[model samples]
Target: MTGTHPVGTRAPGPAGQWLRNLTTPPRGAGEPPVRLLCFPHAAGGASAFRPWRGLLPPECDLWAVQYPGHEDRVGEPPATDLTRTARQAAIAAQWLADRPYLVFGHSMGALLAYETCRRLDHLGVTVPDRLFVSGSPPPHRVAAAPADTDSVPHRMHGYEHRTGTETGAGPDNEQHDEQYDDLAAKTLSADLRMLAGYRPGPAWRVPWPVTVIRAAQDPDLDAAAAAAWQDYAVDDVTLATVSGDHFVCFTRPHDTVRLITGAVRR
Candidate 1:
């Protein structure tokens, strides 16, 4: 297990008060160029994206969304509703958007990321320059698209938010396998319920360029479903197939990092 990489401090809100509520900060090397706001998948948390921190370039900061009731926020109660969860994420994105930023979402996160982008536009806030969708179909096809219950091994590490760091990795995770499985089982079940209930009402569209990142060996990805994403984009839709399974973002993260940096800096 790779150890820890030092993280930046949590800055106060634009008004000077610490963001105790939803006013969160980016977690990466230094000040942002264009931040990469990452949202996790079903039964996933901020820790799932921790591997990308070291793989990311210094110019862009990463804010891996710690969904309510997942990992460090586990005590707050899980969000099984799609729209409400996306609304909360949009609020966080709004607070953290001090400059140009890109959005990356994998699996369930792709849906949340798209919804957040939509909400941002509705709020008159600046939407992401580009939206990177990884291993997930567009909103319209979600009902028919399948769910991946075994992505990234249910990251067992605790979500360390002390100054916005993702630490706590060791062999102990194996020790708590049974316990972790229990928690993961519950969370995954709730997420499946949420996914089963999602309805992407009429008028949902992604006006920005969309890059669909597909995992080479992902059995859950339906080729036609991946191609269907093009229908929702007004700008352009590009498919990128890389290594690993449905959880390619976490399994082979360098592929994702390279794609994100190329997009954000280009």
Candidate 2:
């Protein structure tokens, strides 16, 4: 009853309403469409997947998951716990009902997406038809991040690879503004803390097929690590390496979409 619509069609409200609205998937004219819900990487928003709409087949209903502490939801604090975050996502995605759907995520988003799928299983909600985890090590493979927060700002700065508006900067070098820096610092640290604290094990089981994707040039990803997805998926498992770095999904949208759409078609 209180959640914001993915496409701005409805205003968000309280918990009950939020849960109700969040479950619904955005509709397009047609028979029941296969929905593809995408989660963005850390410090990313739903807008990251907006361009994918054009690349997928008409049969696929593309939905992008939005996280707080970024973009329009800057006022809201980011949730750090995987369960809490996944619970909210499942509630919001409930609107899609029982239609066949796919879940795809990149980097930190990948772990979040997988955990959300697990949460859906716990709630006895319909599971996604497929899961595509890109540019991320398997949940169980990722160890806790070092307990250090002092260098978070420097890490954020480096992770950004840019200092301009496209990098979430405001005009006139607004990132230099004390307020923006403070906000960014807080949110960034909180997100990294969440990432660092995440713990996973082989006990998790996914009944559906899973596709693991990596970038050929991603130094952060080890091919051996990518291969570990085989331990989790109950059905088929696939490994694909495309040209680019860890953020290649956004960097190489054309190829990324090709990989995604191709997987969907299969």
Candidate 3:
């Protein structure tokens, strides 16, 4: 079922605002042939995919999920349960289920995207055409990292520095650190705790194709790890390698966009 409503048409009032908050604005002019629902890494928000709009095909609209306790939703409390978060996301995105769309997630976001697909299936909504998992291993293979070992602020600092270097924004410093730390620390801590406790149940194969994107320089995930995604996909499972590390979504936007568009077109 394709989306019959034209682009920019949405319900009015508080309900509209709530749905709008979960998605990024469409960068395309007309109704897109497909929608790309993007999910960010841990401690990251929809803004992480803001740079992707310019690189994507004009026929493909990008909608980045804005989880609670981040970005514009900063006023809300962080979610502690992955199942609850995925359920909420599935509900928020139900309006777009009739449209041809795909889900793209990086790292922690990959898990969320997959879980959300499951919820959509249970709710009898249209599942995505494909599931793109980047910079993450399969659910069963994922083991929680040691908790509270890394400071939220410090991680944010490093992320900012890496992003700056990749975008030619120059070197990040104490100033940037101070600015984002307070806004992100508490929320990030809560997110980390949530992540630590998450353990995927026995394999439940998805009915759609799964595309795994591996970063060549990403120390955390290798080819073998990415290949494990096959266990979760009953359909085709393809692995594509790109340059850069875990932050390849930001650093290699063009390549990332190319891979995504290619998958959709196929």
Candidate 4:
């Protein structure tokens, strides 16, 4: 864990302010050897990863990406363009390029992380040392749902009814949280629309190591879908499975931390 300067207390410069606004540093007192930038799934915010700070290795620092329209940035409008969001995230993460860093994203966030890497590559910026994608299939393999389909929150509510359960329930419950407010629902719909319309170019390849993590019983992503991630990696691709459904990061935090640390240490 690495210490964060007091919020709003960074030096007077664009770069300093960017760091202050976009990233939440680890809680310890010194900079760690490597940085891990964690991106959240649709309708999720940086606070979703708050538990990880204590579980990750001390040598690694955790920085969660705070997208607009969620958590403390709730007043800002959510981004609907995947390319533009990726470009902005790449630029915001540029400050971490001075050190070895890896990018970790779950579900929709996996796609976002991949696109950010591509944007960084296009800008000749330092590419991530590794990319860890959890519970998402390769970009090309993802089937586009109709852009006007039921939004994630609506789908989540339906799942809740079917299961006769409440939001934020345990491992046996549906992976999605059904407690989203109106604003979250609207933001998630926009993100889903972007995801539905996104189609990666054929020549694109992640020129670094990739580790694909799958939830053992994830309904949304099966073994074949998880394995398809190899198609987008130019280097080695390791597939690992953990216990739980799509929200394993929340349901199996210890296992998630172990898997992540193992991948980072390798």
Candidate 5:
């Protein structure tokens, strides 16, 4: 109930239905059941992947999993635990039970997709056809403190990457009466709180081929961290470099799309 929903779960209210539908195949039948589920970093929403639809092959369906707290879920409370986030993704993966699919996540979203696949394995469910991780280290290599969410302002710190670009750590003019500074702090704190509390297990691993996309300009996504992805995949593994900082996927839409589409085609 707290994280992303599986494909067929009874839709929630207007917002819930929107989230659910986002995970469904957009085109009636042109797109095949071979889907690509995308998870955004902290403070990111499903809409972050709107540009990806045009980049993939017709055999690939696109679904963007919306984590609570951004976009339509703006007024709703954000998730505080990685476990909860993973569970939500697992639930949504069920809709693709009969179809072959892959998962693509960026930064915090990368970790979320990895853990969700692990949870599916535990449940004897079908793992993703492939795993695409961008700008994140393997779960086994992470050794950070649990996110701190006790206060409104402290939570956003968990989402800060080495590059300092936070998708959700901005001013909230509508809610905080133009107290932009305080609003930014609160938004950042929430994202940080969610990140700090996430602790991945050593046993978690993906049985499918895994691809890692690194931002050439992102300080957090160095060669060493990108190489660490080799330990997580059970099948094949590859690492590709792209332009821009941590937010390059958003900025360099065409190149990112080409890379993603090319990967799926293979």
Candidate 6:
């Protein structure tokens, strides 16, 4: 059944493809023992998970969900219907039917991960053995963001975390030109529209284990928001706390991968 969860962006394109960096060699031959699908946040692109290639666990092959209208797929129309995107993702993942796999999503991508899993099960394909949700509130909690045109910049800044392309000078970040800011505004404008129209259909659940991950310093998701996932989970959700802020996964890729691999294996 299509479901809802209390939980929880990017210029995400349509979902017919997966972005992968093959640097991490699989364990033995054809495919690894496990597969991990990484979904990105709003205004974010699959390139965000490129660095994770090296950090992949030996038994797992990492595949980042590639939304249309971004990077290499820039020619295609960007995906706006979240559910349809999830269904497409599920179909694209049919190849993983014979492999043990895990799914991970951050922020808005968390919702995508959950929905994609549901689609897989509905298709009688294969469901992930484990699903990890990070930095997102549950489905019922996601509501249309207020329409305050003046706050678009602030909201754009928020989505930048998902984009991992924060402007300005920093050790890990570099300065971008005014054009980048314009692009962000355009993207956020589209996101506001999506949020304004999006309505979570119903709560969804699965028999597989669901891990709710929260960053210790996340400003948007407090302990209560993180725990709300327990209500929608089919089984008692596993709550995990890790170091960093909302964009923790990108900031600490190694730690994030380590935590995921360790938790799933356990």
- lDDT for every model? 0.67, 0.67, 0.71, 0.68, 0.64, 0.67
Measured against the true structure, the TM-scores of the candidates, in listed sequence, are 0.80, 0.79, 0.83, 0.79, 0.75, 0.79
Off by more than 4 A, model 1: 1-32, 145-174
Worst 10 residues of 4 by lDDT: 1-10
For model 3, where is the 10-residue window of minimal lDDT? 1-10
- How many steric overlaps are in each model, in order? 0, 12, 0, 1, 15, 24
lDDT of 5 at 261: 66
The true-versus-predicted C-alpha distance at residue 158 of model 3, in Å, is 2.4
Q: Which 10-residue window of candidate 1 scores lowest in summed lDDT?
A: 15-24
- Regarding TM-score, does 1 or 6 come out ahead? 1
Give per-residue CA lDDT, model 2, range 1-266, as digits (tens).
00122332332443222221121345655687777778877666665565566677767777777676664566577777865787787777776546877888887788888888887888888877778999878776665435445643554455444323233454456544666556656666777778887877445778988888888987657798888888878766888888877776764577877766775643
Residue-wise lDDT of candidate 6 within 69-102, one digit each (tens)? 5444444666777778888878877766577878
Candidate 3 lDDT by residue in tens digits, 196-217: 7787766778888888999898
lDDT (C-alpha) at residue 69 in model 3: 72
Off by over 4 Å in 3: 1-32, 144-148, 151-156, 164-179
Per-residue CA lDDT of model 5 for 44-103, tens digit only, reads 666666556566776777777766655555556777888787887687676664667777
